[model samples]
Every structure is written in structure tokens, then in C-alpha cells.
Target: MNLESPKITLEKSATEAFNFLSDVQNFKKLMPENISKFEVLGEDKFLFALKGMPEIILKKKEVTPYSKIVLGAAGGKLDFSLIGNISEIETNQSTVQLTFEGDFNPMMSMMIKGPIGKFIETLVTNMKTAI
Candidate 1:
């Protein structure tokens, strides 16, 4: 699997950052407005269907105190837990790193190619407001 790890540094409180980043429901708001839809599967899980995108279901595989939230995403046909993953958070320095992991198929790569940067920028922009 090709892993794409993206990092961001923010000026915010630990509790604020953790709460904002941990809630999957806030992702659509935190994300760029270009994103069309986000569905929270549970407290730490979500299924996102981007505009002109394939559906992806994910779960928060791990979480730690103000430090991290790791998510695993996959197609329904696959093992579900082993397909794709995203990890992010910060306990110090007000910095955060979000990493995307999984087997990179052509479609996923294409989607990533077009908008990952904007997504990150808007994510930081919007989530910062949550602080």
C-alpha cells in the first residue's frame, strides 16, 4: 500500500484540538466546502461519499489522549479493516500530522491528486476556528 502522510501545525489547546479532530461529524465542516457529503458511522467511524468519488467507510482504529486518532478505511468487499487508514493528532507543540494509508488504486490516486492540498488547507482553516 502507498501511504500518504500529511502534517499540519496549529496554534491551539490540546483539548480543543483533540475534540475537534476526533469528531468525524465535524469533518465535512472542517474540510473544504468542496466536499459534498460526510456520514458519521459512529462516534469514531464515518462513511464519506465525495462528489464524483467512490464511497469509503472508515473506523477509528485507535485513539490516545490528545495525541492521536487512527482510522481504517476500506471497501465493503475487502476485509474492511485493512484497506485504507488515516492517522492524526498532537499532544505537544500544537502541531498535527494526518497520514493516509492503504493500497492506492488508480481511482483513489486520481482523487487524491486533484484535491488533497486544498482539503488540508481548508481543514486547518476550519478546524482552527473550533479552538
Candidate 2:
């Protein structure tokens, strides 16, 4: 399954937003207020858990300079990736959109799609202030 977030303009430049997101530790600032747990495992990985979800461990998989960042599940029953796409709109401003791709059976996808969509929306909304 694939889900994309609505693009949002950021006050920071593409490079600035990319730099902030490339660091796993900075993700805490962008997580929803209902986050139950959060921890930086290393320079390239982090773990977090929402109120009703199992803890998720994510590792930085790839980065394309200031244009994109891809994070994948480290080791879990679920296999998924989260991608951040950044585009510069002005010298000091940019737009960002997030994509979530998951490998799940149709049944599972149907069961979780709504929550995942909400999760993506919350993350994108937080970026307006967290970036």
C-alpha cells in the first residue's frame, strides 16, 4: 500500500529541512503529542510508539542530498518505508510531502489504512512548526 501526505510549505529551505530530518534525534520534535515513547537508538535510527500501536524501530535507509530521505523499518513484523520529499520554493522556504509504503496483505491494509493515514497527516501537520 502507498499513502502520500499533502504538501506543506515550510519556513526553512529545503536543505535546512533535510538536515533536520536526516538526524533521527530530531524526529521527536515532529511526533504527535500522543506519542507514548520515543528514543534515538543511534545516529541513523530511532524508536517510537504511539498510544495504541506497538513500538516501531526505523533506520535511515537512504538520503538524496537535500531532495529526499528514506527510512525503513529496522526489524519488525511489518515491512515499510517512509519517504520525505523536499523541494525548494524560495531562498529560505520549501515544500515537503511524505510518502508511506508498506508491504501488507489486503486484509491487513484494510484494517490499518485509516490509522496510518491519520498518522501521516499528523506528522505532516507537525512539520509546519517542528521544522
Choose the strongest candidate by lDDT: 2
User: What is the Å distance of residue 125 in model 1 from its true position?
Assistant: 4.0
Candidate 2 per-residue lDDT over residues 1-131, each given as its tens digit? 99998899998999999998899998898888899999999999999999989999999999999999999999989999999999999999999999999989999999989988888888889889887
Give all candidates' CA lDDT scores.
0.58, 0.93
lDDT of 1 by residue, 1-131 (tens): 34333455556656667777677776767655556767887887887765776677877777776666666764474332321122333344376555544455777667664465454445555654655
TM-score of each: 0.67, 0.97
Candidate 2: residue 18 Cα off by (Å): 0.3
Q: Which sections of candidate 1 miss by over 4 Å?
A: 1-6, 77-93, 105-111, 114-118
The residue pairs that clash in candidate 2, if any, are none
Let me know the TM-score candidate 1 reaches against the reference structure.
Answer: 0.67
Clash count list over all predictions:
0, 0
Candidate 2 residue spans exceeding 4 A from truth: none
